[model samples]
Structures are given as C-alpha cells and as structure tokens.
Target: MIEIDALTKVYGQAQAPAVDEVSLRVPAGSVFGFLGPNGAGKTTTIKMLAGLLTPTSGEVRLGGFDVARQRPAAMAQFGAVLEGSRNVYWSLSAWQNLMYFGRLKGLRKARVAERARDLLTGLGLWDRRDDKVGGFSRGMQQKVAIAAALIADPPIVLLDEPTLGLDVEATRTVKNWITEQSRELGTTVLLTTHQLDVAQELCDRVAVMRRGRLVADLPTRELLAGFRERDRYEIRVEGTVPPGFEAVTREGVTTISVRVSDPGEVYEVVARLRAHGAVLESLTQVQPDLEDVFLALVNEPSHAA
Candidate 1:
C-alpha cells in the first residue's frame, strides 16, 4: 500500500516544480505502472517515495507510515531497485550479496540462507551463486540485484526500468517473476518503465504524467476500451484507391484506414470505393493500444504550472 498526497518537488531556483501536486493511491497486491517520457519527473517521484530525495512539499506514506516522519518504519514496508545504478556489490557473489542485504534487514543468517537459496534458484542463478557478480552478464547481475532486493521479503517493491537493457528472454523472465510476486506472493509493485507493451501487459492500473503533472490514471483495460470506442476502421481493397484517401499497398491489395464521426460514414466510404471499381477484400475495426494513448496524452498542450 502506497499513498502520495500533493507531492511537489522543485529544484534550486527553477520556476517550475519537477513534480507538481501529484497524488496517487496504489492498492495492496496490485501492479501499478507510472509512465511518462523523458524529463516527466517519473524518477524524481520514485526517489521521493524511496526516501532517496525529500519532497519540496506534500507527503508520501508507505503502509500507513509517513515516509518523512517515520523513515525506518516506512522503509521497512518496501524494497527498491533504482534505475541507472548498481544495486548490488559487484565484487560480491550472488549468495553473499543476498546474505549481506538480508542481514541488513535484520534477518537471521539461517533465514537469509533459506531465502537466498529459493530466490537464486527461482531466478536461475543458483548455479552461479558463488560467482562474483562483476563477472556475470548484465542480465545475471540484474537478477542478483533483484534477489538482494527481495531477500528481505518486504511487502512492496519499487522497480524503475527493471527490464531496460535485457535481451528478450531475460526480459520475459523478469516480467514473469514480477507477475508471480504480485499474484502468488501478494506483493505490491510500483513499476516505471519506457516499455509501453510491457506495462500494458503487466500493469493492472496505469498513470501517465506530463510536465510533472498527472494526465491520465485508470485501469489498463478501461483506458484501452475508452480509445476503442472511437469510430475507426481498416479496409482492404484489390484495386485502385480513389482520391481524398491515403492507401498503403502490399502485394496487390491496398489498405486504407479511416475514422468517422458517424457510423453511417462507413457505408459512404464503401460506396466510394465501389464507384472506383475497387473490389472490397475485408473490413475490420481498428483497435487502439497503449502507445497510441501515450502519444496522444504526452503531445497535448500542457496546462500545468
């Protein structure tokens, strides 16, 4: 459980805040995506939540403990893997890294050992547990860092770009692990990433930010459905496309996509194509995805201060 209230962060003498009155409530055991393009203050917000940075105004609470006032108790509620930073000791073995972090969390040696075995095995690093993390591949190093983060068995996790540079297989492995943690272990996840498809697939809810302000926040399916309600269609024809229409040709067929304000306009498009002696192949409704929604939101004129 995470709660943010009117969180604001202004740097130095900058006229505008990096994060402005951003508020959110992330439910327990849910995967929530915090999305935005570069310089949208996503990392700034996450840092404040992780206590790595203090907010200029407003508050953050973790599991009902105010992050600023109850730093130790609030920190006990979550583990974090920050972006563009090494979360684990490079010279330490994977097992050693976990053991060290677990002990730091006040876990007993025996308990830490047990958790290390399970986490390393689950992450496919058991065989290399004794190898120095500096010698491991980037993906393996990332896995070690994640294991260390989870070594404490905290109820919540803050992951920023957890899959940034991994290969397809490594990315899938991490995604599956995140899913399992939320579904089976009841772990709350606050994820921030540039990968829209990954967020669309894994996030239960999503919030988009622009110019340090919250633009859209909703359940992923509901957001997609809202865009799907628009009247858009894709038509494939076997002959020449008439004027006033843009077409893409593949093989011998031309595809034209159009959006109409009224459903009756679709029939008019069909009639026009027929008038040009074009043989209709197939017609289907166009579906909008997360990328489309993201671009539309981020490109809009900013009204925030």
Candidate 2:
C-alpha cells in the first residue's frame, strides 16, 4: 500500500540527515512495524511518507500516488495518528471532533454524523462523546484521536505509538481495536513504536532502524529464530555434576542451566546426572524473542547516530 525509495530528510543545516536513504515497503493487508531508538529518525520517515514533511531527496509513494507529486491524492489514501493527540479541537465534544474530520474528508452531514457515532462507540467513547475534549483525560483524547483518523476509513493507517501512555486496560482496548481493524476490515497498518512487545504482538514484519538507516528487516518469527542462543535447558538434581554438559547452578541448587544443541544432548546429559544418583525434576526449552533480536541489531557500535 506504501512504498518509500531512497527517502532522505534533513532538518535545516544539521550535521547529519534525520532520515538518510531509508527505503521501506508496506504490503496491502499486512502490518509493518518501524522500530528504532529515540532520535533514530522513525518519526521523520513517517512524516515524509505521510507528506507532512517534504523529503530533501527521494520518493514516497502511497497507494501508487507519488506523495510529493500528488500530495492531495496520496494523503487521501492514508490516516495518520502522529505525536501529540491534540489534532482535534479541545473545546469540541468527542463526537464533534469526528464529525469535523468526517466533513473535512468530504462526507455529507448525515453520513458524517452516523459514522462518527459508530466510530466513537466502537472505540468505547460513545458514553463520553458529548463531553468536551478539553475535559477528557489523555486516554480518552487518544480514543477520540483514533476515531478521527478512521473518520474517512482510509486504506492505510500510520500509527506512531498508538498506545504509548495508556493504562493496561486502555492499551488493551487500542490493541484489540487495531487488530480488529486489520483482521476484519483489512486495513494496512504501518506503525512506528518503541514498544517491542507491542510490535511483536501486532506486527507481521518489523524493520529496525539506526543512525537514520534501515539496519534490518525480517519477519518477527524469523528474526527471533536467528537470535536463538543454541537452546537452553533447565535441569533439577541433587547429586554430582553431569559429564558432557556444562551446568550453571541457580535457585539454591534446585535448578541448573545447560546449553545444548539438541534435545538428545539434553537427554544424554540428564542420564549422566541420574547415574550419580541425581533425581530428575523437569526440563524446558528456551526460545529467543523479538527483544533479543532488536537488541542484537540496534546495539552495534557502528549503528550510532
């Protein structure tokens, strides 16, 4: 749904570009996560793609329309929730905010009102729809912000840390709604977030950025598998140490860790320990997660901005 090629951006006369030659693609009906540390240019890239900031050099195309060439048409293809959820009028009611954006999207008065109510209710803001946004809490304002984004029901949604500052319940609500939007509505989501857990849970694929460059792009599972540290085992025993396996004791000698290549090696090690009159308690396998891969890629000294 979106394609960015050789995208570069610089602010004023900065020594280095905020976004440097970053290219990305978001396929239709898929969720793509943009990962980076603070000031790594994730927001700059998103802004270029959203046509909010013009690129110094490079091309940004949204749904086949060149973002710089056809700004209006390109923007019409995307809905973005960027930093600061104050995009809506503070004095306007929640429903009023949605209605305003709906009209801005060129919807008729009746259609705008109907869609605003549906979206507000879906986001659990219908009960408070009449309250002024200036009086609503941050989480409530975020819900209304999301409603405003969906007012036009654009095919692509760019969410920058949608659940950044919410409580567990509010985060859950937003996550579930985003999932529903992707699954049932087939909305293509391109999100930039520092929350690795949220990215792991929601993104089909993730691209990690550093120093204004695209460092790694991989499927969440494949990335995790690549970071697997041989496979770890937990053994419980009381007697002597195993012969072939190197064991590290923890938890008051009730637990030990053994790193092995395969389960058969684990079994062999367990048998060796049992030969010394050690009782076997339980065994478990460890798998690497997105955090492991993210750290591995982003911690490189060469990636410094």
Candidate 3:
C-alpha cells in the first residue's frame, strides 16, 4: 500500500543527504519494520511519506496515489502517531482528542463517535475516555494517541517509536496492537521502533538502513536466521572441568563456550568432556537477534566509510 522510489532528502548543499536514494514497497495488510540506528533517516523517510516533509528527489506513493502531487488523497489513506505523541493534544480528553483527529481526517461525526468508542474501549481506556490527557499515565496517553491515529479507520498506519518510554507491559500492549492491526484488521503498518524484540516478533518483513542507505530488507525470520554463526555453541557441564574448557556466565548459567567448524570438532569436544567424567547439563547453539543484525549493519566499516 506504500511505495517509495529513490527518495532523497538533502538539507544543505555540502551536507550529506539525511535520506539517500531509498526505495521500498510495503504490501497491503502487512507489517513492515523500518529499522536503523539513531540518525539513520528513518524519521526523515516517514515524514516524506506522511507529507510532513518534501523530499529532495524521487517519489512516494500511498494507496497507489502519488504522495507529492495527490497529497490530500494520499494522506487520506494513512493515519500516524509520530514520536512524542505529538499528534494528540495534551489538554483534550481521550474522547475529544480522537473525535477531533477523526474530524481532521474528514471522517463523518457519527462514524468518528463509533470508532472513537470502539478504539478507546479496545485499548482499555473506556473509563478514562473523559479524563484530560494531561492527567493520564504515559501508557494511557500513548493508548489514546494510538486511538486517535486509528479513529479515521485508515487503511494504513504510520507509527514511529510508539512504545518509546512506556514500561514493559505497555510496550507489549502496543506490540500486540500492531500484530492485530495486520493479522485481524488488515491494516498496512509502516513501523519504526528501537525495540528489536518487537520487530523480531511482530514484523513480517524488516528493512535495515544505515547512513541514509538501505542495507538489508527481508522476512523477519529469514533476516534473523542469516545472522546465525553456526560455529558457535555453548555447553553446560556439571561434574568436572575439562582440560581446555573455561566456564562463562551466560544468563546466570555457567557455560563452556566452544567453536566447532565441523561435526568432527563437536565430537572431539564431547569425547574430551566424557574423558574428564563431566556430566552434561545442556547444549545450545548460539543465534543472533535483530539487534545483532542491526549493529552489524550500522557499525560496518564499509557503511561508515
């Protein structure tokens, strides 16, 4: 539902582009993760998509409409809650905020009321709907912000750092909302979050950016599987210390780290452990998470250079 083609953003003549020639396509009803380290241009790209910032070159299309030229029609396809919950009013009640935003989106009053009621209640804020946002907790405020974004029932949602300062529980709430939006509601989500676990579990596909350039984009599972260093393993032994083994604390468990390039090397370690009369506890293969992939891409000498 969202298409970007060689989009570029430049602030000054001599300065590097905040967003280079980045191109991407987000399928309808899918959750696409937009990930990068700080200053990687995720925000800049989203702004261009949201019609908040004009791109220096190329184009953005939303719901098949050119966002630059058909801006009103393109913006009608999506609703957004950017960083700091800036889209919502601090003084307005949750109900009022959602209704106002719905009106801004050109939703009919009756439809806005119905959607506002459903969304606020769904987010467990029905009781607080009449309370001023200034009196609500950070989590509560965030929920209201999300409700506002969805009040128009737009087919697409653009969320940037939605769970930024919330506690674990609140973050989980927002993550589940993202999951449900794609899985059950069929809403296309373009998400940018610092939370890797959220991206790993919730996103269908993720695109990693570095220094305004696209580094990697693939299915979440496929992307994570690519980061596995198959030679690395950790084994826990209870009885005796093998001659060449030294225990390292990993997640409160003492594990002997070993690197085996082949099956024979693994067998050699087992043979040595048995020879030492060691009692095997557990054996686990090491796999990298989204954060690992992100760090590897952003910190690469090639990307930096």
TM-score for each candidate, following the candidate numbering: 0.96, 0.89, 0.95
Q: Which candidate number would show the highest TM-score if scored against the true structure? A: 1
TM-score of 1: 0.96
lDDT of 2 by residue, 187-296 (tens): 99987887889999999888999879988877778777777776787777665665555565666465677887776787777777888777777776667678877887
**What digit string (tens of lDDT, one per residue) describes model 1 on residues 140-228?**
98888889889989998998899999999999999999999999999999999999999999999999999899988899998788768
Q: Which regions in candidate 3 have their CA more than 4 angstroms from the true location?
A: 249-253, 302-305
Indicate the worst ten consecutive residues by lDDT in candidate 2: 243-252
lDDT score of model 2? Answer: 0.84
Best by lDDT: 1
Candidate 1: regions farther than 4 A off: 302-305
Task: By lDDT, rank the candidates, best first.
Answer: 1, 3, 2
Displacement of residue 117 (Cα, Å) in model 3 is: 0.6
C-alpha positional error of residue 70 in candidate 3 after TM-score superposition, expressed in Å: 0.6
